[model samples]
Target: MLYLTINETNALLRTAHTDAFHLEVSDDHSAVADETEPMRRVLAGLPPFEPDAYPDSWREWDELVGEVTAHGVTMRRVRVVSEPLTDYVRFLQGLTDRNVRLGEDIRWLPRHLVDQADYTTDEWWLIDNARVAFTIFGTDGDFVGAALTEDPAIVDRCTGIRDALWRKATPHADYAPGG
Candidate 1:
């Protein structure tokens, strides 16, 4: 297992054109609550991030595709986006249109799903391709995301929990939201 802060992960995404990798994301609502707003921009063929240099996700997406096409590793992402439907559709469309498969779990529920004690308040994700997992807060700088590898048993346990959540997750379209 490896540890990476958000910046490290972003860097990996940027330069890792040769390695095939899958990115499984647990939608971090603690930071961005409006999925549609981002999707609206993306569907318009606009960049997903702000107008900053690194804010544009196209380069990262292109690099990720290079990994998949070159290394047989398809980038798979799972997100539970709060929605007004249109943004969810747009976001899903962008992800699905890429070399990535995007899906969602119960985290999109009107109420939060994970226990506060079980996971921190930050956004979390497990990169199955690298077998590395970690979490990042919305407001944290790119360097704030922590890589988990301190304890093998504990990391494996968390991985299992993530898998369980994945198994139980439904497609975003199938979700009832308030249900």
Candidate 2:
């Protein structure tokens, strides 16, 4: 595992091929998530999700997914969890065409883990397993701060959290907040 400050993480995300994104939103009003949209697009290499429709930017995201798949990368797994359903739903519903994702392959973990996350402020930890990229964000609406690293410990912990989430999450579609 490598240790990268926020800036380094952003850089890696730019070139990361296959990633396992573990995005956590501690705040009900997620400002950090908004700021990282560009990073998301770069890592995903897809257009934004269009809110007007269900699979608004399905093909574009699919193209990106296809690219990863071609690299023998399975679906780029993003384990995002926010506060109350109202908050989480608002966050999910606000996604654009490229960002919008159906529960098809996503896993919804128990919300209790939100309290278990190691952080003092609202943050996001995006782990690119293939590239071994780990990125973190600390922010309030317009003011955002971040850290990025490649430490094996960071990688392992992120992987561990993902594993826990996978084991705890209900199948994506059936996910109901607070359960």
Candidate 3:
């Protein structure tokens, strides 16, 4: 099992060829440093974070998504969230349009509709159907590191999970976080 720093994972993402699918099971990644200020702003009822005001890493990510999508890579994310929405999930919901605008497909899956035993608990990014990068979060839900695996079994399982959940998830434009 090889581990990758966040930067390393980003680099790998930049190298993607066909598709990049992300599965997020956590309701809160608020402890992530880049998210703190935005989460606070959201909680305070401020308008969504402006693109120009995004954290440096986030801005870079947005750029990367735009670049990759322009080159024909399909990027998709499915977030499995519990409702009534957590503050952090609400925050993400507010910001999802920007991701969609950048050409990434984002979806939401209500937790109640999913059977826990049928899926992996960890959040992961499966790239080009070949590599899987599992995100590791601290106990407090802070971003830690990632484990990258190319083992066929792990990649296959993640692919299956992503496909099944994606079919059942609601597209960003159709998802109503508060409802």
Most lDDT-accurate candidate: 3
| Candidate 3 lDDT over residue span 1-179, tens digit each | 79988788888888899999999998877788778888888778886577578577877888899888988999999999999999889889888887999989999999988866557788999999999999988787667679999999999898989988988999999998654
User: Relative to the true structure, how large is the alpha-carbon lDDT of every model?
Assistant: 0.45, 0.46, 0.87
| Cα lDDT of model 1 by residue, 27-124, tens digit | 33323443445666787888656856433355654654565445543343344333443444436545553333321222222225534333332344
Candidate 3 residue 123 Cα shift, in angstroms, is 0.2
Give RMSD to native, each candidate: 6.8, 7.9, 1.9
Model 1: ten consecutive residues of lowest lDDT: 102-111
Order of models, best lDDT first: 3, 2, 1
Put down candidate 2 lDDT per residue, 67-98, tens digits, no spaces: 44455433434344554555434445334223
Each candidate's clash count: 1, 22, 0
Query: Where does model 3 exceed 4 Å of error?
Result: 48-53
lDDT of 2: 0.46
